[model samples]
Target: SAVISQKPSRDICQRGTSLTIQCQVDSQVTMMFWYRQQPGQSLTLIATANQGSEATYESGFVIDKFPISRPNLTFSTLTVSNLSPEDSSIYLCSVAGSLSYEQYFGPGTRLTVT
Candidate 1:
């Protein structure tokens, strides 16, 4: 099992300002994923960051809006750019386990854009 921790557990940000969230894993991981959970909605995958390659953003998410960095196997960062009220959501970091279907998640970063 992997232990994941996210920084800035919760924050209140003004509209149009961006926030960068950090995710750290206790052990080295090959697959790290970023997700967003909007109010009253299910988790949506933002991107997948591998250790050596560029992150792959999901259909609705773009690199311009959500830039992800995977500097090494144990750390990654996701920055939400040009924030807006609708961007307020809980951002979560997750890593895949040995099993294909198994995943461990970090305590989410809750962002409230006012």
Candidate 2:
């Protein structure tokens, strides 16, 4: 199992500002993903960051809005650009484990845009 941790567990920002959330795993993992959980809503995948390749974003999400970087196997970052009040949500970092169905998630970064 991989242990994941996110930085700036909670933050409050002004509208139009951007925040870069960091995800760090204790071990090298190949499949890392970013997700957003709006208040009272289920998780929505933002993108998948694979080492040495460009991050693949999910529908309704664009690379320009949520740019992701996977510089190596154990580290990744997601930057939310041009934030708005609607962008306030809990951002999570997930990783697929050795088993096909196993997945682990970080604590999550909670952002509030005003």
Candidate 3:
């Protein structure tokens, strides 16, 4: 199983600002993912960040808006750039466990835009 932890559990930011959140894993996992969960909703895939490759973002998302970096097998970071009121959400980092198909997620960084 994979254990993931993310930094900055919560933050209140102003408009036009940016925030970078870090994720750390206890084991060397193959794939790491970033997700966003809006208020009262399920998680949505933001991008897939492999250990040595560029992150593949989902449709409706762009690299300039959400830049991701996975420097090694067990560490990654996600930056939310050019923030706005709509950007307020719970950002999470997740990784699929070694055995099961289920993905384990970090506690998430709750951001509020003001």
The lDDT per prediction is: 0.96, 0.96, 0.93
- Candidate 3 residue 34 Cα shift, in angstroms, is 0.5
For 41-97, candidate 3 gives per-residue lDDT tens digits of 999999999988999999999999999999999999999998998999999999988
lDDT of 1 by residue, 1-114 (tens): 998999989999998889999999999999999999999999999999999999999999999999999999999999998899999999999999999689999999999999
Model 1: residues with Cα > 4 Å off, grouped in runs? none
lDDT agreement of model 1 with the native: 0.96
The window of 10 residues in a row where model 3 has the poorest summed lDDT is 94-103
> What's the TM-score of every candidate structure?
0.98, 0.98, 0.96
Q: Score candidate 2 by lDDT.
A: 0.96
Give the Cα error of residue 2 in candidate 2, in Å. 0.6
Residue pairs clashing in model 3 are: none
Off by over 4 Å in 3: none
